[model samples]
Target: MKKILFSLFLLGCSASFAHAHMFWVNVFESDAHQPPHAMVSMGWGHTLPMDDILTDPNSARIGVEKLELYDPALKKTDLIKIKSKITEAEVTNEHFDIFPADLAAQKIALKKDSLPGVYQIGAISKATCYTHYIDNKGRYRIKHKSKDELDNIKEIKGSLKNQSFAKAYITLGKWTNPKPLGHKLEIIPLTDLSNVHVGDMVGVKVLFYGEPQSTSLKNNIYITAGSNTFGLDEGFNLQSFLVEGKAQFRVQSKGQWIINTMKGEDVTKDGKLKDLYGKVDTVYHTASLTFNVK
Candidate 1:
């Protein structure tokens, strides 16, 4: 099946490039003048015109097929089979799948009834992809007859890849500034408990700098602490921190202890970041901590 699809893809390419952006797969025999290989070219639109905007061009994903067998027939058989342990082969699709990669959000406590307004984390944008898919009892149900039909795929088709997704738990209670747009936050350590014990806890007071005075957002700061990385954000706060996304951990291994934090995505270059008010040219978010091991 893979070889068939691959061959079809390669043939499609040379026959006269399918719609420019459509993904193409290639197939070739080992000893053949042109060995089996596939090349992917991303595009902004079907025509691949000069003005088709291209962002992050080199981001590529490749899928390869490798099969191993035991007590081989040694006849260079076209197909290889195994006894009982069945390993499912991976199926590749034309679309690109980019996941959140699990970002860890920390919870920071603030004065009760702080921002006075409620906030909901909803998708401000959707993932515009190439194809749509359905699911069967056990496998993916592709809408088209085969990969060939995908060349003519149209836009505004099916649900946006990651749209209509699960919403973030309502971090109710407002944001004087909806967008947490800012550059360069500060970190101030209140206590020198860098050499604390394993079971110690500390109190850290974080002061957000460049906070717009137009809104009472003094209480919008949230902090997450871990053994090695610490994370701080505005708006939502919770106890459980996500593992896959990096965060800060105040570690106390035996007699050696240290207080540090890890940065989340989007670190701006050296320049002033504009805020909603447009009054403050640069914004700096800071954290102060004091803890004692229990």
Candidate 2:
């Protein structure tokens, strides 16, 4: 049976793979055939990955609401807008056999330059959403179709905290600000972002609303690259708390690295980020940075 409302299933889609927020920045000029611009993307239902976005841009959450470019000095944040697309792929429907089983989202296109120093870019998406899900019995608890699956849905009610996501970082040659971009809860590098090496102890500090607040993060913080996630629920890979507000760790693998805080609070009543339905009194903040070691 064709889904009466295709979007209802979206709210309950599987997200067991998303360990952290990830945004990928691809320098277009890296390939001789590619342009000199940049493309940023995110992924959903999975850990947001850099390489995956290159092959499957549709893995994200459907929009590139904000893409900002910051120079080494952290002087300016230039906003760039990209397109959003929702796509469906035919994966497997052995159980839910009436609709497209796989879904993805993608966004693209931002400007890049030839500046030799370090640079920082951020990609963010926002949404006012409502969801209702019904779980089925046995064999992993599948979901069954319902006549009212698309109707009489209740709005998700809870805390009023909005959510913001960031992805990607890199330090090459010498000079990128690993400092916080002022997200509600952010991770900034006290260690130079532009000079990290394989064995270097890259210093980091957690800030809550622009103030140092690493003590609260305690065991709640996490770091990952590829499928490996460090701390709590697992084990602290190489992480150490230097003080109440700073933590330091080393990267083991090469390629791209992502540093992030676990779901944290966003306590700001600036009145700028109101929810679509009404006022959100509190918000959850997750920050991620993807950079390369090689």
Candidate 3:
């Protein structure tokens, strides 16, 4: 049993490593005579500015819990309820035990004439996965699908302890909100980005469970803009852990930006837990938000 379990996990690892998948909303100007709308796409890519990654058949089937279009101009928020298409097939990935893994939003209409102001839109998942896996020196990072390769596969039993949040920003015609959404782990803005420009500093706060994340160790927080990953600029990815629940940073570029927060939690209290592979389960959580600069 032990050998079979290990072999299955080994096969899983070789086939996939947890890839970086992010939720994002793409905005485009309505062709001359159409109502403005947006496409909520869950993209798979190496990092931020997911401009070049695959879309369409986009990704996932998780039901969207909250998809709100916050209009600062009118201080009115519209809730867009999305229907998730759950396939009859089961996907036994690191994230989904035996359920299908493909929930996402198609296109949706926005508030009419919602231009010339700063607008915030985001989607929270009502359906979350309790993923189980191992965490070993980043070697066993849960891959979307494990591959078949022989490398130093570091790992230990684990599960996901975080919820997924996808946020976005827009400037329809000059108004702003700049208020935090108070997510469990939120990377919300503290400054208005409706009319931001280059050389202008847009402030942001990182909150874990509604409070500040102590320390700004780059690792705990990853700020990325199109083509420019903050890790390369800062080097080492700020390996320190988020000591406090509060963290803050500023955007220094003009483009679509995605801020991702990752941290591990010790789930040892629940007592003796083991995965199918007979290893103790440890878990970590991740949260992300996106906005445009200028």
- On TM-score, the candidate that comes out on top is 2
Report residue 163 deviation for candidate 2 (angstroms): 2.4
RMSD (Cα, Å) of candidate 3? Answer: 9.6
Candidate 2 local lDDT, 147-248, one digit each (tens): 223333333222222244564543234564555677666666676654456766776777767776543333344433332433312422343443566777
lDDT of 3 by residue, 24-68 (tens): 554433334456655655432445444222222323223456767
Provide the TM-score for each candidate, comma-separated: 0.21, 0.56, 0.55
lDDT of each: 0.23, 0.44, 0.47
- TM-score of the candidate numbered 2? 0.56
Candidate 2 RMSD to the correct structure:
8.5
Tens digits of per-residue lDDT, candidate 1, 1-294, equal 433333333332222112112211111112122222111111121221111222312211111121111111111111121111222224435775332211111222223333333221211112221223333333322231222344333331221111111111112232222222121232233233322455444333222333322111332233333321121112111121222221234443332111222121211344332121212211222221222233
Enumerate clash totals for all models, in the order shown: 27, 9, 40
Candidate 1 to truth, TM: 0.21
lDDT pick, better of 2 and 3: 3
- Top lDDT model: 3
